[model samples]
Target: MTNPLFYAKILLFGEYGIIEDSQGLTLPYSFYKGALKFSSLDSEFEKKSNTHLTKYADYLLDLELPKGFELDVQKFQYEISEGLFFDSNIPQGYGVGSSGALVAAIFERYSITKYNPENISKDQLKNLKKVFGLMESYFHGRSSGIDPLICYMNLPILIENKESVDKVAIPESEEGKGAIFLIDSGMTGETGPMVQIFFEKMKTEGFRKTLKEEFIRYNNACIEAFLKKDMNPFFRNLKKLSNWAYEHFRPMIPESIFNVWKKGLDSNAYYLKLCGSGGGGYILGFTKDYEKAEKMLDGFHKEVIYRF
Candidate 1:
């Protein structure tokens, strides 16, 4: 009955680079969340979701390989059989961690080991990412488990590298002038194909060079500057990261928002980045001046997340 909701997550920085051990900053977005509930799943969406969860439960049981992230899942099977399903509004395939939230909810409700503080360490986060990656891989072709971990912990997490993650405090919204917001694209994104495209692009020397030299540099620097609360460096690197994402990661961006994304970067009014794996869902925006950005985004609905 009383299942806590796991919110969606946004990978603020470090997208493809995170796989190569780049630094990442992730935050929970509560605007969309999922919670386990008992209800008559009569609607098509509800029935399909319930059925998918059943299959996922089976997938969890079927895993017998060596796993760094293991959990006692027998209890979860029992719950799954008893009408356990996540009633969520978070749209799947939008790259906003829809399946990740569900995976976290299941683990939080059923995982026997409580690795909160004493047992939880960076090693544990790695183990978790591995296990969660396997578990969530049932939903998507591949996963990093970072999204599920963010949803499970319900805390902002900073990825020092692929092997380490730690809880972080977000800077306070003191002045309320600058803001972070999301612009909805109203379309779902496919993860597997997009990832394939990225891999193909990586095979090209020029693209790979840009990814390593420019994208990684700006993305990693942004993480450091943001964490250090060095405003000037943070904004400076944000612009760079935003620009890089626009140029090289255009395929991942939604076609509808491409123009707005470019215009924002060009004008320096606001810079847009992929909220998740791009394709669609919500595009995250950062601007020193929200009113100006809002005016620029007049046609689309922009939801303010934070201000500083």
Candidate 2:
């Protein structure tokens, strides 16, 4: 039997804002992916993956999954003992959904009741997100399940709010100079710690007010403009969103990216924001001219995910 592939994901918008019932936009990033596979477990990497899977299997066995969603834990354990491992290139702690792809792959292969990703209903998608949240929490300590949900669906997901999520169609990439890209920070970030920082910041009434009034407003506007293919408003709101992150999400931003994040705001050549929880993973960038942004961001590893 052939194993299915699960792709990495990018939470393009609404990283911390989503927890506040704000809208979010996420898309599958096929550049990095993972799949379930059998290995001899000779290499340290393979052995490590197998060991993690063994522990994960134990967690799943004790997980109280939502009704109508079930994994064949016995089969999962048997496979783990048989040297089953996730073969993936998705960079861990990069905020590109590494563990998410692994979770999606496991659910794809071991779920006792499966819903077709191609034709799933809105309720099914919500249920799947709930189940994924429970499963992936074993890794992140706490999870919103959005990452695995995007990986499993392999589609752009628009989170209208906490209770509303559905597949969305994004404007297709064009050959124009404007682009959306990723910049590697040369360090790994822990989602748990970054999230703790966010929660801590949330305790401040001023932070909470700004997040709802300014941050979410810009984020939702960016999503709406991007979906409508309105470049002017998209970039306008994107700049605001980027600046908001720069001012409020400083702790989440790694030291290496601090200067460059400001440089974009000053130059108006590009804007940078957290790819996921920030701390040190990949930083998301937007530019009207990829060439200029490339020149300004020299020495940093960059990959363009979308071009306008």
Candidate 3:
């Protein structure tokens, strides 16, 4: 049987800053998605996927599974062993939330009991995120689990702060030249090292202060404006957020795209930010005029995520 698919997620705001309790806004990308499905007792990719899933199920079973967050580890392991495979089109390490989708799908389909997002309290969401974080840590050494929760719920998730979260709805895309897009970095990035570097930088008071006061402020504004359907304010805040990341989180941006990333900001043709961990993967871009950004970023292939 095929489980429901979870769309890939993009952390529109709160990339690294979110780790410091910065406000975050994340939504699902329907263009790319993944789901757990049973395969015939064959196919290398299927077999490999099943084996990997089994290992994960075992890990979860070993963990002191937290309260409120529930999943049928035994049955999930059995089903996965009985030919289950995660069949997905979402690209891994492209910062599009590959592991997130899998975690979402698994939690959704096999959870012995489910927590309803509607009647559920905010604390429940946080707890779920914590549990999912522990479960997803199998894939990435560390995880916020926000991506998986958003993907799993297929809703716009807003992180009010470290302790509060809920499903939200952002303004729908408009018919216009303004757009949100992704640019391939042409290399894969691992979350572990990027997170390690982020933690290392967190040791500095200057960095932490800037992140809390400046970066998070702009990031939160961007989320609020976008949710309110105020494109003008959204772009205004996006520009500031992009600039903040460029200045403080330089290492996250790859060496190759460093100039282009900066040029976009300087020229005002577009503003680019880390789609995920940055170092390498997909770089997110925002521009009121897609033509201008396209002209500036000639060689790199780009996909429009949303239009405004």
Model 2 spans with C-alpha error above 4 angstroms: none
Give the candidate order by descending lDDT.
2, 3, 1
Q: Model 1 lDDT vs. the true structure? A: 0.81
Between the candidate structures 2 and 3, which one is better when assessed by lDDT?
A: 2
Model 3: residues >4 Å from true position, as ranges?
116-120
* Order of quality (TM-score): 2, 3, 1
Best by TM-score: 2
Q: Model 2 misses residue 152 by how many Å? A: 0.5
lDDT of 1 by residue, 1-308 (tens): 67788898888888788876788889888999999876577677777777887787788788753443455678776765666678898878776789899988877776666566334677777777777787788877888889998888778889888778888888765666788888888777888888888889988999988888898899989888877777788889889988888888989999889899889978999888887677877888998899999999888877887788
Question: The CA-based lDDT of model 2 is what?
Answer: 0.92
Q: lDDT of each prediction vs. the true structure?
A: 0.81, 0.92, 0.84
User: Residue 53 lDDT in model 1?
Assistant: 77
List the pairs of residues colliding in candidate 3.
none
Candidate 2 RMSD to the real structure: 0.8
